[model samples]
Target: MAISSTLRSMGLIGRCFVHPIFDYLVIGGGLSLIVIPAVYLLADPPVMRDFTMLPWFILCSNSAHFAASTVRLYTKPGSRDALPFLTMVFPTVTLGVLTLCMFEADVIGRYVQLIYLSWSPYHYAAQAYGLAVMYCVRSGCELTQNQKRFLWWIAILPFFKVLLVATSKHVVAWHIPEQLVWSQVDWRGGVNLVTEVLGVLAMALPLVLFAQVWLTNRRSMPLISLLVIMTNGVWFVVFPLIDGFVWTTIFHGIQYLAIVMIFHVRDRVARPENKRGVVFHTICFYGMCLVLGYALFNCLPYGYQMLGFGAAESVLLVIAAINIHHFIVDGYIWKLGRGDANRRVVETVAIGTGA
Candidate 1:
């Protein structure tokens, strides 16, 4: 009888947790599960051969996102105006380009494809969600100033990741294998310099904006935001300058874990009544931390080659894990926001006042 009751309660929880607009959690989680194993399997090959498999994983993951967005569009047309359309459209277009470039014959083409695939899709998706959250703030969603600040920080984290990877590559040139250093010069002519400068600008822009927001709205910041800022400060600012790739990657992984935990806390606060939502967020939060922890512990110190894996293969696995967690959390919050909007509309109509 106790077991039966437990099963029934679980069933009820699952039903209540069903999202009509987008099965983002399932899609993201499923693709991540598949992509991780596929990457591991494909990693045991020649460098070129291993690199060849990355687009397939990226294509699959991006395709899942595109499908989820399409379903979201169809189910809730009203919510379309809330997010930036370019966020979705650009990823679709870029993913298409990446798909084509994966098959290209030239080495340079593959490198370009890898860079875009690394940063663009998630960058845009985070931006879209950030835009949605900002809309919530504008519409009086009750988010603390700190929450807004944290979301803004996350929205621009990709730029930091790019800069950190590039700078680390340069600063650790002596430790890196001779063959792995593709570009010799720090700043080159034309496109290379442009890309480098843009990277620096992108990384710097978020810090400037974060400082401005904090200064303008210091009183509104939440404890979680403060913690996130401190954690990110240590990883992005303090540690990277002191350590090289091994320690930096480990610390960066910890920072990423903190971000996930902080967001989970925010999501819970945003919808305390939704127990199932809380459970889902908790599952994703811990699950991501577990997976990433395992990867960093087993994969980083050894290096991709030491694990008998190519760089592209290792990147694909790590990215799949991180992106999947991000997608699930973002989708969960978007659905929560939609539900909140509907409740507000009902309340306003019944009360006969917008307030």
Candidate 2:
């Protein structure tokens, strides 16, 4: 009872994990952003070019997170019936694209890589938008359409900075002639200024919106939701400055794994015919992800290399395909609209001590 009172005082809303602690730390990603980076800085680990070199980390973090969405989508009962095109036809489409990438690793593969890279920041921002709004909706904060538009603008504001960075001379040389690069027109200073402003807006706008909600409603928005917003801002703007790609990706993966497992375990246990405990379901889901992740990231690349593709390009193309495919799969599986199974799972107040 005391714990429940504390949670209410903290503005707890719809939560993925059993307790607020796991939801705030793992799903919210606020605390992990601080703690994980501090540990990494102090430990000063060796730089790893390829994650597959660390088999355990790959199986647990990188590979497992990518595979989690795929596992969740296919394993869910009625998912095929609910999202037939995504569950059935999408795999074939993804496979066809992967094959094209392999055959034209020099041409199609490069574009595929760029597409994945460019789309990733947008994807991360979209997830942040989705999760933050989800908590509000679950907590009975009915947002006006205008309010949603404002929130989305704040969420995607960070992507503009990345877009500007991608167009700079160093990376832009890959596609366009050097003379026509974004920086050559003497727009570098302007671009830098704009990116800096966008970065500040990305971090500050969330706080402004949170305050607006409080003023309008006479109550605070869920603390977890506010944390989710700030955490994404930190992930993209702050962590990237520290470690570039590795920190953001690892933290994003951790967030994904936590939320995905919550949904997977909850759905399994809610079934009347299912008898397994939360721990059992959690292990089984992660174990499946590990096996599939290993196969997709490791074995598939090896097979491509054996067929005469360069090892590096083979890995890159496979990764591009998997990341793009997971992005699409997530778009389908986590819908919260009327009649969506995920709506039931996501909006419920799931308080327990199990998963």
Query: Could you say which candidate leads in lDDT?
Result: 2
Task: For residues 210-304, write the lDDT of model 2, one tens digit per residue.
Answer: 77876675555677777887777776676554354566677778888888888788889999999889999999999999999989998998988
Query: Best TM-score goes to which candidate?
Result: 2
What is the C-alpha lDDT profile of model 1 across 1-355, one tens digit per residue? Answer: 5754443233221210124111122311222234334644887424423566744433333333333333333333244455455344544654454344334325434344344344443444353334334323322334456655556655455345545455432334335643455366433355355545544544454455445543453322222222322333333332233332322233333323333343344444456474566567655545544444444434542464464545564455444433433343345334445445433332332242111
lDDT of 2: 0.76
TM-score of 2: 0.88
Look at candidate 2 and give me any clashing residue pairs: none
Q: What is the lDDT of residue 233 in candidate 2?
A: 73
Clash numbers, per candidate: 0, 0
Task: Give the local distance difference test score of model 1.
Answer: 0.39
lDDT of 2 at 219: 52
Residue 13 in candidate 1, Cα distance off native in Å = 29
- Work out the TM-score per prediction: 0.33, 0.88
Which residue pairs overlap in candidate 1's backbone? Answer: none
Q: Any runs in candidate 1 off by more than 4 Å, and if so which?
A: 1-99, 105-109, 112-114, 117-218, 240-355
